[model samples]
Target chain A: MPFTGKVLVCEEKVHLRRLLSLIVKSLGQHVLFEAADGEETLLLYQSVKPDLVLLDVNMRQRDGIQTIQALKQIDPDCLVVILTSLVNHLTAEECLRLGAADCLRKDLPREEIAVQLARIIDACFGDIPA
Target chain B: MNVSDQPSPMDLKGRKILVVDDDRLNTRIIRGILRPQGYEVADADSGEAALAAYPQFLPDLVLLDVVLPGLNGFETCRRFKSLYGDACAPIIFITARSESEDVVEGLAAGGVDYLPKPFRAKEALARIRTHLQNRLLLEQLSKANAAKNRLLGMAAHDLRNPLASIRGLTEFLRDGTVGPLSTDQLDLVNNIHDASQSMLELVNELLDVSVIEAGELKINRAPVSLTALIEKAVYLNNINATQKHTRIVLQTCDLPQPYLVDAQKIKQVLDNLLSNAVKFSPSGSTITVRMEAGANGCSVSVRDQGPGIPKDEQHKLFKDFGRTSVRPTGGEKSTGLGLAICRKIMEAHRGTISAANHPDGGCEFQITLPS
Candidate 1:
């Protein structure tokens, strides 16, 4: 069965946001939303209440960590997967400890990223929960 | 470069030479030989005097006599060694003790060479000149090497962000995420994309090397499954395999025990080898990944069906910027620093990585981690 859910991608770069939107669409009949920074992401999270969030770590104003904290405060059940090029493992782990769904490497080849996202979608929306 | 024949006297002008001799006659004679050659000479009547004069004179070289009035030459030499540490200026012992035993003792005491007593002026001058020249050259080379590393680190770091942006934008163009194009336009965009990706990989690898060399390579070891790591590496590498129309086969023996490793770094090493196999092999070939368990340790090997590395160039494969005669089958580019980084990461894990020609054909790269 094709996985379906709402995904909100928060990235500072417009191109990355657009690309991630495209990948999320290619996955299934999932509704998609995009945010440029943490503040915008939280405002959208309040209104949209998307089933999934694709967060970037390094951002202006508030970062992924802060945004995730705010999102959890709103709804602890919120599913978020980090999509970043962050080389620092410690930061990634900190996000995980704050209840992140998973962390994906942005530096990977496009197909590999798509495959990983697909796997996450299966686990998140299918029989298995991530 | 004969010690006696080469350095012009002017080259070492004003180089300080401390004469640590109790005899005033011997000090004067040595000064007469060195001063005419443009050397600045300072004399100490005894070992204690020489140690006291050291800080003020800051001599480039020291000439000590073994048969001193109080402190022995060997003892003084040892003291000098302790003061300067590794880059201590050359210490030549001017002593009557010319026995093989004395020469060994002098060297063992950190003396550079022995200028036996009753020495000819020419021999003393030659020895002094050679050592001084060597010291100056070593200092210069070390300075240059450090400067080069600093430059490399900065340049690589500066180039990375912009290069990543270019790669991302070009990838968007190639994927038609931005817009579609004609065949020729698509080819141009694809070429640009590939080039940017190659440069991005090179820059990233250089950054990894510099960061590790800065002594910041912290290996966070955990009980990781090597078999699972290899499986993921294959899954990721298969994207390249699909692009090249090659098949990747994975074989494994059950490794139930948890093997300690930094999962991310080991994955990097495996990825490099698997991608290399993809890069060098023919389009319609097969790549094999195997994980084995041994009594001493566990091992992972990646074998490619490409032209085996030539015996002569095999030695160059793992060295920094090392390249071989074979070219990538698909015109794929290598960072050249990939294997070098892989070797470094393995070394951190107390593991070893090696490459060899497989008996069937092509080359195989294997890494072993001690259990």
Candidate 2:
């Protein structure tokens, strides 16, 4: 059974958003939704109800902290993985404590990042029946 | 003495001066003298009154009389200094006691300067202006320095994201994440990866320095084996040393008991020292990491067999941006901030880091932590 789950990519930068969406797609047959800011991210998430979210910590209008709180409030069990270049220990810990599934640095080696994402996706969508 | 020395200070408004004199006449005289210079004067009849008004008025400079009804000027000055320490406003004792000991006593009590009784109008104004000017200048400098640190932190943070992008994307291209790359393309990708990686390291170092400068360097201590940390550092540095045909010989003389320390931070310090040894050493040379453990304290020293730092430049080793004339043999980039960061980390751990030339060969950097 192939898991074609919805994954929302929330990032402000266009190039990074594209790269992240592609990374999510590389995992499996996943429906990708891209949002440039937190507002759009919430709108898309509400309308689409993604199985997982790849959120950037820093954004223009609404940042990751506020957005993550709102997301968790919307769906307590929703998996929100923080993909950020804000590569600080404190921020990562804060995001994870705020119920982010994982806070991965964007600068991590591609293979390492791929493995982490694959594990997260498999956990969420792998057991789905055909 | 020229009662009318002609260095008139320019008028600046909202500059508050606190006048603490038992005599109402003297307070009025100081007020009359400084009002023309655009100083807002507040009067306190006694040392007790001055202390009471200090919090509200927050005067830039204080003119305190030695004689008071209670809590004499010296006592008040001492209390202010002890209470506020370095942040206490500059105090100048203006009193009838013109004896030389009186001047010394006033200064010893933390008064920045002293003005005699029946002070010359011009001289009194000049002294007040000087102290007030110094206080304002110091405040400006401190604020400017803090702002600079903030700007450095922000700029470094902003650079990190794009740098990460460049580094990650380059590696992905080289690793064939999307598609396989040709030989020439792979070479270019490697170049880009290396460039961005070094740049990222520099940016991170800058961030560390700024954070430390802003007094945000935190040490989280946990039980960590000193010997194990040293071994791990040696192993990590060896990976790069092997590429240059250099060897790191770790001589852990004795195993120390596991102690509470920020293990990650200690590891970083060790990594910096060992890598520096590897970076500066010639190919086919041996870099020795000798750890000496004992009851009172333990020290780990990284000694490299390359050209030692010059006597003149050695003193500059632990300062930020302290780049000596000594060049790396393996063409590895030196951030020059590594030692500075290492020093701060050591200090936070209540340890000390020092660099000195070995008798037999190259420079040795050692860090010692008290047990």
Task: State candidate 2's TM-score.
Answer: 0.84
lDDT of 1: 0.84
Q: Which residue pairs overlap in candidate 1's backbone?
A: none
After superposition, candidate 2 runs with Cα above 4 Å error: A1-6, A18-34, A38-49, A61-76, A85-99, A107-112, A115-130, B1-11, B45-48, B66-75, B95-98, B102-109, B253-256, B293-296, B359-361
- Whole-model lDDT per candidate: 0.84, 0.85
Per-residue lDDT of candidate 1, residues B1-371 (tens digit): 47995434437888888999988888888988899999999999888888889889988899988878778889888888898777677889886744668788889999998887776999889999998888877777677766766677788866765566566667777778668988999899888887878887888888787777666678999999788788888999999898999978999898866889999999999989998999998978999988888888989898988999999998888887887779998987776788988998999999999999999999899999999
Model 1 alpha-carbon drift over 4 Å, by segment: A1-130, B1-97, B101-112, B118-122, B174-187, B238-256, B282-296, B358-361
Task: Give the candidate number with the greatest DockQ.
Answer: 2
Mind giving the per-residue lDDT tens digits that candidate 1 earns over A4-121? 6678999887766776777677667888899999999999999999999999887877988899999999999999998766354577788999999999876666677789998887
